[model samples]
Target: MVDTLQLILPGFLLPYLDRFMQFGQELFGGAWQDILTVVWTVIKVMLIIAPLLLGVAYTTFAERKVIGWMQVRIGPNRVGPWGLIQPLADGLKLLLKEVTIPSGADKFVFLIAPVFAFTPAVLAWAVIPFSDFLVLANVNASLLFIMAVTSISVYGIILAGWSSNSKYAFLGSMRSAAQMISYEVAMGLSLVVVLMISNSLNVVDIVQAQGQGRFADMGLNFLSWNWLPLLPMFVVYLVSIFAECGRAPFDLPEGESEIVGYHVEYAGMSFAVFQLAEYSAMILGTALISLLFLGGWSSPFGFLPDSAFWLFFKMFALLVVFFWARATFPRYRYDQVMRLGWKVFIPVCLVWLLIVGCWMMSPWNIWK
Candidate 1:
């Protein structure tokens, strides 16, 4: 599909806007024909980034509103009608604010830290399969790629804290590093169970694996998904992701009472950048949950079109659960969070992995 578009685009547009198209093509790539491919890549990237940015903006607004309703109060009604434009107002305010660097801070590292954090979250989307042949890049080892990229964001936190030259920020970053490392183990192990069941590392193949099994043939498609067979691992993955992204109850890195946490020294857009990274990771995690556990873009009924709507619907549902946890749960003690990740979740994931292995080898293997 993408190749077809790439070939068709230049043939149709090059005649009308020859000079401008040639400039873009030559600037982005080596040859004129390469222009269409470059343009197509850019369009796919924009398609992913634009919706992600909008989702992040509205996620903030939705969090405030949902939490407010939970607490029996109206939220963000002053900025625009029913606070529809609250996120826009907040974004503009941040953009207009002055970015400040402390006297002793490492200027270059401090400046680049936010970009380091933000880049990985967005880049990981390249391999995600929204629907059949709809991804920007369909790598064979996509799950591995996502794990590797997501892990790099930890450096941004450490850099932000160290470059700021502040003890409180350093302590917060240390906690974040510890938290991420502990949870990441459990998270990866949980996914190992998924890979074993689906028998594929390619995300599109994994989704397709869930589409036509016995339960799906019986018109109980939802029951046929990996979430049912790997229920324990599914739960572990969900909790570990919460800790991995530093969401509420596990948000030790940004604890409000702990001297305002890691990015406390950051001001204006720099601080906002950290926030953007965090929220982007949240949304990415939501998408992974949908694809890996809830059956990516799969319709419950056979009659529905195989489109991206189902994927986004599942992602949105998971996002609501994320905000719900934030509103309902109190912050865990740093030690308790670490204990949950290392001692509890890790052991559970390991045991479940063994159980799943045995189940897969047995004559009762449902996935077979």
Candidate 2:
């Protein structure tokens, strides 16, 4: 069993099963440097993945706890002290449960759909700037890369519905596809405003752009951020992010009382994966909103030191607003969602883009 486990395990786990073996190889027989380099890369990957996983877990806890407070009730105090361990308990429960597929379901696609849905949310984090120097990939076209990667997840939703062999699931997937596509246009257009102001597709550059101007010089960094000059686009982007993440006020895809959801046929861990994807996407959205409009790791006042702490503080503030919105607003009706995206947001973004373009050519262009 031990031998079998070692053979089947991933390379990272293999080191744990027999650490000395990896280093005892002839290729690196006595070279400590080579062995440490390989191990360091693994550590770097974990440095990113670990916090993200924890963030997703706690995000679930925060949602329930915050909503509980808003509704005048206590939430999830059963599993551990103050429900601090609730996410872990939920994970164990999901892991222990059996996942079932409908007899008529396409087993292969049905099994893969959750993975397809989940991967992009994780992948997009590769380009996110946690601080001035802390990012996995500092690509020049990070914005474009994020836009492309995120757009692929809709296919997973489409597959989920198609493979389920259930009309309700199919309907849910169709709604999801349409909803995502509509809001994505608005999302993209709002981002265009950021790019125009920053004059770069790099996320780090976007944050850097917000750090310029007189307000920054006087130590009131918040006033210099893109949010002030581009308030309309910021508003449109925030609303579009809510829709993109399938949160309340835009959660038409998984209208639980109506279509049940695209993953309605999913059970146990399969369903859990969908939830993970959703929450991760929410965090991703918050991260993007922080980087683009809220100034990434730049402190509200320049008194704070440059560190990942400020980045996460800003990220947390935005995340709290996400929960607050869920508590405050009722979900929009499907027709209303479509109308707001197409009629209102897109047009507003387009007009704003033209306005920004003209301003860039005018004598008052601050970006100059």
Candidate 3:
């Protein structure tokens, strides 16, 4: 969205800013432009982060309402019009609450652990393309950056578990760590196949690459997207995202019926922060799935103009599936989860990666 203030503000503001820039340069004899650039960069980042925070908040509302409908029950309808403002109310409650540290707990790490988890969810957005020009950091190695940054969140889980000074919390963290690591291997391999086909780490280039081929030429662009050609890897990535985000069936880390999660000792907003991190990561996972497989911001049909609406719509569709799966499936046994990740997903991804690589090298190559 364009900044409304740019149009509303006085016409003389630009010249005034220029005069202030010159005055600062004369006084400090240094890079006033760089300082302005930094300030502007911070503003752009805030634009990204502010919406993301709202998205994360509403995701919980969506999940609850979706699951409630599936289970034949009314969800949070008392807070606002059809419970639209429920997330906002919840945020207010969390903010007004207190942070509690358990006795004998490592206070510093206990406090900092949520930051480790939360920062990564926010960091991944830096490279996520909402539209052609609507990204904070459109770097060359954006895909690599996503993989690397997302991997760090598990450490936060482990630290939260350990620093809480509770055995159950530690056990939960261990489960989360192992689960995330195992799934990362399969997910990474699947993305590698995409990299082979697209031949670029830049997220924009990957999406643009999907906007071609016979189907896109025919104006059935959805058919041209990677989800069709990379069906198996697409499945792998989807299932891996569920496990990675610790959603149901794969949510062994926090078997709420049996064991508390890594943040068991946390209370009030401190606990809410961990939850914020989790749902933020869930949003990130959905965004990644939409981008890597569903063609990012591309329109479903060719005649429609590509926009952020398509990307957000696709993300919402995938998120409904995330909630549907959570409602439909039961939690897996921890051992079963491990077996699937290692014995099934890993080998499958590896084999599929090999097959895709070989196919690309064959005379039948269509991606070229």
Candidate 4:
């Protein structure tokens, strides 16, 4: 029986054993190098996440200021210099607020859902290529990996809704799930044109492809961006992401007027987690846009090496657009939102994908 078991296991286990042994040897062979790599990774993650957390805090301040300006009112001038400390004040308030769990909620899941939502929001930024060599992880499948991670974040919303045992939260979660799923398809298809032209899944590779001069080595201009060739796809992606992020005109999930939305019952820091996740996701989306279509970190005029400045500049530009849309547009009607996603954005993206595919294969090679 022992011999038979060994013979049977050999077929199934040998490959895994070999892989494990190889991994073990690699780890042991360069222990110091591995330690340095891990330390560097930790530092990089902290650097990225720290600024993001600060950005989230300041984004709230920015939003209030922008919305206040839009409404012709002075915004947040009370706390600290020019109200710069308002986010801190708000953070303190939320921290001091009472955290109340509902009488019959699932305590464990309810407590953990916010963490789940926030984790993916932060993790998705890891693959974003800030510059040629500044990316945290230069995965071959970065585009798909980002999509997968962003898609997984919806589960956090769903879980939060279900665990809350509140009708409004459940409805909000349902709306969010449906909206995210619908927009994700359009967003993915829109990006397909980018990948088709770049012919690479690596974000850095995509940016470099755009950096190549289009005409007689006249150094690539901004017009050579995917945004120009794939204008329709670009529009679709922008709108689709607005929906995916549950931002204004697409914030059906969190309709404060009619429904309190997903975090309806959440309080204190638990509620803060949802807000943090939302802003983080917004930053992630903007970063992806910068990397995918805006020549990521590359100077549009080609006078400068691709640097952090360009990455942050492009990302901040997109972030401004996000806020401008929120301040300018009204929440979309739920049915209209769904129809736009299904009937308009998805179909347009699909047709554009076909156009891009055909363009890639054409003898003329316009994109090339």
**Per-model TM-score versus the true fold:** 0.92, 0.90, 0.93, 0.88
Poorest lDDT segment (10 consecutive residues) of candidate 2: 18-27
TM-score for predicted model 4 compared with the true structure: 0.88
Runs in model 2 deviating more than 4 A are: 1-38
Clashing residue pairs in candidate 4 (N, C-alpha, C atoms within 3 angstroms):
none
Tens digit of lDDT per residue, candidate 4, span 1-368? 22333476758786785575567667787584576468667977998889889998998898888878888988999999999999999999999998778878999999999898888888888888777887889999998999888888888899899999988788889988888998898898888788888989988899888777563156556767667788898788888878888888787766788756788889999999888888888888888877777778778775656688988999888988888898899788888989999999888888888887887788967656
Point out where model 4 deviates above 4 Å.
Answer: 1-30
> Pairs clashing in candidate 2?
none
Off by over 4 Å in 3: 1-30
In model 3, what is the error at residue 8, expressed in angstroms? 8.2
How many steric overlaps are in each model, in order?
0, 0, 0, 0
Per-model CA lDDT versus the true structure? 0.88, 0.88, 0.89, 0.83
Compose the digit string of candidate 1's lDDT tens values, residues 1-368.
34464567867764656566667666867675666668778987998899899989999999899889988999889988899999999999999999999889999999999998899999999999889878889989999999999999989989998999999888888888888888899999999999998898999989999886888888777888889888989899999889888899788766776535678899899999989998999999999999999889998776677679999999888988998999899899988988898889889998998998999899988787
Query: How far does residue 119 in candidate 4 sit from its true spot (Å)?
Result: 1.0
| Candidate 2 Cα lDDT to native | 0.88
- How well is each residue in 1-368 modelled by candidate 2, as lDDT tens digits? 24555787998887675665554564566685577667766776788889899999999999999889989999889987999999999999999999999979999999899888888899998888888777878999999999999999888889999999999999889988898999999999999989988999999999998999999999999999999999999999999989988998787766678646688899999989988989999999888888899888888898877677777888788888999998998888888989999999999999999999999999999996
Ranking by lDDT: 3, 2, 1, 4
